[model samples]
Target: MSEEVIQYTVAPAPPEPPRVPVRYAGFWIRFWAYVTDLIIVGAINGIILLPFIPNGGREFTIGFWTLTGVISTIVLYLYFLLMTKFSSQTLGKMIFGIKVIRKDGNLPSWSDLVFREIVGRFLHRVLVVTNLLYIVVGFAERKKGIHDMIADTRVIHTNK
Candidate 1:
């Protein structure tokens, strides 16, 4: 009897690039998430101001509008600051299963949160052109907005 020998060759597996975890939230989802947050915060502000608003004012004054704007800005800033520092989620983000974190997957410090949520975010909101530019960049540049670049942070889906 003659024995036959067979040789098999196996190809090496391709190496994977380092797994950088990115959340990759699309434009519409992010937009809706922000809208949800705005509604929640706006409702809170309205509740706080219900007593002060005149029942039948002829019209809103410039001063009243200005005051309301200032108060709303402060409330938004505080909301982001607290959520980013403590739990990495605003009420909407919490409900939507998203979170903010450092690019390196660490809990952001108070200063980081403040700088990111307050300074960067405020600037983005104030400059309409820049905000529009950021939306373009977010679609073009791996789902990161200008504020995220400035703060070296990212938004990711949270399991909880």
Candidate 2:
């Protein structure tokens, strides 16, 4: 009869520790990423346009260069938009260990990626002074650039 009385006690699982605060990529890291991307784009541009130069970078007419500029701009925008859309990281971003994400901690959808890479980034370059969005990056709690803010995106370290 003594073996007939068995009691069961259940222990609750321990609470999960709070998640570590997310860290935003800093200005200099982002800057270097941009510079690296520029180098890549510049090299590609030079290769594609060199044949059109005809005299080793010294004999292009205004019309030729104007067309070249348009082509280069299109190429640049496509490069940024496609890369960001498919991978959320361009070559430079991959090398630099950063990525673009929506503010809600999710990957961006195609439209969002397009707006960010095109209207935000491409236009930012065309309108150079908008590059000063870095000022906001330096001051904002999330370190977001104007492009990032406009697209409701954030750049974060991936440690990859």
Which one wins on TM-score?
2
Residue range with the least summed lDDT across 10 consecutive positions in model 2 = 52-61
State the lDDT at 117 in candidate 1: 89
Backbone clash tally for model 1?
A: 0
After best superposition, candidate 1 residue 57: deviation in angstroms?
A: 5.8
- Model 2, position 108, has a per-residue lDDT of 91
Clash totals in order: 0, 0
Q: Give candidate 1 misplaced runs (Cα > 4 Å).
A: 1-22, 55-65
The positional error of residue 52 in candidate 1, measured at the CA in angstroms, is 2.5
TM-score of 1: 0.73
Tell me the TM-score of each prediction against the true structure: 0.73, 0.76
* Candidate No. with top lDDT: 2
Model 1 lDDT tens row, 9-126: 9999999767765665556656767788889889989987666666686534566465566777788888778877889878877777777888777888777787788888888887
